[model samples]
Target: MLFLVLLGFPVFILCYMLAAPVFGYLGDRYNRKIILGAGIFFWSGVTLSSSFISELYYWIFFLSRGLVGIGTASYSTIAPTIIADLFEEGKRTTMLSVFYIFIPVGSGLGYVLAAGMAGLTGDWHWAFRVSYSLSPMGLSHSLWSFVWSSLGLTAMAFVTGALGMWVPLFLYRAQLAQGTVSPCLQETCNSSNSLIFGGITVGTGMLGVIAGAEAARRLRKINNKADPLICATSMFISALCLYVALMVILIAFGELFLSVNWAVVTDILLYVVTPRRQSTAIALQILVSHLLGDAGSPYLIGITKNDCSPQWSFRSMQYSFVVCAFVGVFGGAFFLLTSLYIEEDRKEAEQTSPSSLNTSSSSLKEAIFRV
Candidate 1:
């Protein structure tokens, strides 16, 4: 079961990484609503099918996950581009923040829902069925909300991928290192730890989304090019918080700080890209971010943990997290650099907008009539 759980994430992420570019291209060329709807339907159908899988055929479950990844890739790449087309400036940032808040909120709810359903029914399959039933409602909502955000995302991904995969183990090791035995020796203790983590994640994530959006909106009032500055500053602060969390004992604070980074980056990406190229920009962001981020971090951390001497033991995971903190610094630097060019890009894109061109033509026609 452990092996399956570990292996499934990479397989799904790999399929998502591969399919994103193709779907992104299609999104630019086709009716985005149709593509988005089809993706939601396909993923939901596959998710429903998983509830029926027999215990004898476990491989089918993995396959279904991969297929679901492909389906989600279509929606993930295109939906944000559609949102970008629908809004401009601070309004776009606000909408994207609202869109992304659901990510952590849904994740927390999933864990709670699954646990509740399993506890009530004494069967896990019912949990899957309940979730599968809700897919259509999400699909019914207009497709909404990624992107330059990719650099920060890649950095953020590495941090999250490594931390998420290893944090429980690190906590267990910390318990041992302190030479204090507690109730954490039981499996239930691990579940409790996970629930605590999820609560913090959801709470901080929603706060960060709202706070970041409002901050960006205020910054934009001061300067139109302020989005990238918000991203850069948030990322740098997040990196500093991660470093402190690594050195100290306050992991929850690090998680809280990390939550704000995504909102800022998403605002920056949409603010800079032209509507005509938003899909392709988002696709590239997804591809680059995952390729460098989650796709390899789990394996990388696992190998790092294994390679360390026996004396270091589980402390090896801590060392791996240190690497992630430094990577956060690198991500911050990328966003800082992006701030320098983002204004120029936004200006160039605006100059090429159809409305601007039409206005220029109208002026020319008036001058000719006067002549």
Candidate 2:
């Protein structure tokens, strides 16, 4: 059981990194919401089907998990893009942080649920049984047939997947046809005047600023002096603290917390950046954060565990996390201040660079020449 649990990390890394971007491409070319919804719906089905497996069905179980991986890949890629579409820059980081709080909490709960189920039955079989039995009826279709039935079911699955692909295309055409501008596009227009625009230059940061500004605006409408700057600052700080707490939980009980943490973190990162750049942002974040921040922390801990003591390994990692806590807090603060800085920089550039400003103005006029 311990080996199975330990093995899942590498498996997750393999499947997640490889499969997620492919689904993301489908989402980008089609429709983000549809892709996300289908991904969720399909993964839920896969989770449900896992309940009935025995050793005889172990291969089937692996295949089902692979399918689930693909589905989530689509969702993880698109969800962040959707959030970016909906929110602004300065607030994007905070909002993403808040959204990510679920990763740790849900993972904690999943373990509790698994343990409770196993304890109640005294057999692991019931865990899968309950999962499959409780899952929606649609997923059971594959189980009802045998030998010859596999071909028909495979064909059916293909048709369903293709249909799922089309839903996004229809939604994209509808949104664009209706002249509903994406929130990111709207921000590019209003950003010149917004304080949040001064912070980060990336599309993700832009979405955060727009979202934060809208939230601040709503608050101000209710209270005369509701300074968005102060509100954003506070939220980002609080979120950073929450993230640190989660990291402590993960490092302290690495065995149990890792899988769910991966799922949750991917979801949060996806939500922070824009839809168009979801795959790139997620991939980049994975590559960079793992490379720079915590990538080697686990290996370092394992070496200590073997060389010194198990307790020592965990203890050493905890000290490292102390530093991470500071980084998280500082990172949030940095995002808020950066957005304001970028907005100011753009304004200064427009004021100082007459030729460049003129070129931009002329291009804008040409694009909107009719208006």
Candidate 3:
């Protein structure tokens, strides 16, 4: 059971990685709405079908999850391009933030809904029925959500994938190191800590999104070139926060609270890419980031942990945290580099827009304000 549960996400992500580029290419040349709608319908049907399968059959369940991933790839790859096409610059940042706010919210809701349905029906399979029913409603709405969030998603995946994956165990070991061994030993204590962690993560996550958007909006008002600047600054701060959180465990929550804002910073960066190639660019970004970032973090961290001497078992995971901290810094530096090119690229994109040809001005002043 444990192995199957662990196997599910990576298989899903693997399928997602494989399918994203293909779907993204199609989305760029065809009707995105149709692609997105088909994706939702296919995934919903697959998930609904899964509920009928026996829980004892792990391989079939894994295959179903992979199909879900392929179905989702269609929606995830192209949705943000749609959003980018609908809005401009600062407004795009704000809209993207609003759309991404649902990620953590929906994640939290998934936990609650699953738990509630499991309790009511006394079987986990019934939970899929509820998800299948609700998913169709998402199909009815515009499929523009989350891909712009991919920038932040990549960064968070790097950091959280390395550190957050082991947080509970880290906490347990930390307590053992402090000679206070009972903290994680109690089921209630563990559950309470899990709840607190989830609550803080979701709450701070939404706040970060809102705060980052507003900060970007205000900075843009002061200077047209502030978008990437804001992202660079936020990512730098996030790196610092991760370092502090790792070094001083007592302040870990406070640091995590600050680090959540990095999501907003990275999200706005996606909008800075060329608009015509947005889907392809996004698909590439997704591919590289996940491939280089979270996909290997867990395995890397596990190897690091095993390489340590048995006497240093408690500290093995802390070494992984240090790697995550440095990665956060690298991500920040990448954003700073992006800041250097964004303004010029943005101007070039605006000039190439169909609306630009209809107007008479060669200056960006006219192009920037076009609807």
Candidate 4:
């Protein structure tokens, strides 16, 4: 059943990855705000309607997830381009940090709200429905930005996907193994793990985003290579943090480092890819990242755990989690590779941007290097 639930995420990602190119092409040629707005509506409606589904037709829920992906496609493909157009240099990076911070923040909040409401009401469906009551709402790249950054992000996604799906369960199992908690025999087990996990996610995510943006802004003054380097360093440290599974403090630090990549990576995309092609670049980045990244992470972790299981499921899961650490190292390496090309890509992007008219390539390169 956990495996089945995990499958929907990859399915949604696959749909999201595949649909992004279409939206990318459209966004480049059309009005992006309109497309973004339309997508939000489509996404919201589908999500809201899915809450009403009955267990007899649970499969339809998966289909709705796929539809949700299409809606996500438009926003993912185009929204960053809007930001890129609006801001420049350090300002752009800061704005983007604010933008991408919402990814984990939303996830963290969703987990808290859904779990709290469900626990209080004793109906899981109400968890999904609470969003309607609460109201509110609301990649890719040039080759260097797309290729290296996406490679890095893919690993981040992989680790995030596995951890996101399994951490609560893993925590529960750990306590059980220690004889600190009893095994849950109820159909629905009430536990504080989700609440604690959600709080950690929100806190770590918020702090990480703020710290990363400030670090990048300061570092960029001296180094043309700061963004990718920051990403590389964060990925490496995150790998270390993730390897120490039993320490929740280490896990929090791991999440902090992981969150650092969100904005930095997007900022990398904006500077390396031209605005005209940004939508497509963003789309392609999403495609490659999700295709290779979170799309299969949770499912792969699940199967690996299942295969390794003997008497203790927790031990097997711990073994499966080791994979995430290695992947994080590879992600860091990809960013190092990115540093090789970022300076050249930034100049090229500047030359081709809409505002580059009448500017010489030499002048553009000079301005980029000065930054």
Q: Which model scores highest in TM-score? A: 4
Judge candidate 4 against the unseen true structure and give its global Cα lDDT, from 0 to 1: 0.79
> What's the true lDDT of residue 26 in model 2?
66
lDDT per residue as tens, model 4, 1-371? 34435656767888899999999999888899999989987887888898887767868988988998999898878888898888877688888888888878877887788778777986666765776555445021346655877788889888888878877777766666567666653224324777777777888888898888999999999999999999999999989988885434236888889898888898888777777777887888888888887888776777644333233776777777888889999999999999998888788777666677546666888899999
Q: How close is candidate 3 to the true structure, as a TM-score?
A: 0.79
lDDT of 1 at 268: 60
lDDT of 3 at 213: 77
Report the C-alpha lDDT of model 1 over 91-204, residue by residue, as the tens digit. Answer: 777888888887767666665666567567866667669889888730101111123456777887787777666665566555555665453463444455556656766787
Query: Top lDDT: which candidate number?
Result: 4
| Model 3: lowest-lDDT 10 consecutive positions | 138-147
For model 1, which pairs clash?
A: none
Q: Can you give the lDDT of residue 306 in candidate 1?
A: 41
Each model's lDDT? 0.71, 0.41, 0.64, 0.79
Cα error, residue 1 of model 1, in Å, equals 2.8
> Per-residue lDDT for 170-283 in model 2, tens only?
222223334564534532222221211112112222333344444444554564223323332433443354345434432121112211122223323332233344555554
Q: Count the backbone clashes (under 3 Å) in each candidate.
A: 0, 28, 0, 5
Error of 4 at 350 (Å): 1.6
Off by over 4 Å in 2: 55-66, 86-98, 124-275, 286-300, 304-371
Compute the lDDT of residue 103 as modeled in candidate 2. Answer: 37
Q: Which ten residues in a row have the lowest lDDT in candidate 2?
A: 138-147
Residue pairs of candidate 3 with colliding backbone atoms: none
Tens digits of per-residue lDDT, candidate 3, 1-371, equal 23664687678778888888888788777899989899989999999998887867888999998999899888777877777778866577777777666655555455456546655777778878888998863110111222323454466567655553455456656665677666336443443444445565567567766777787778777776565566556667777776677666642443333344443543543444445556766676667667767777766765645444433665777776777667666665665665555556556555555466546455556677884
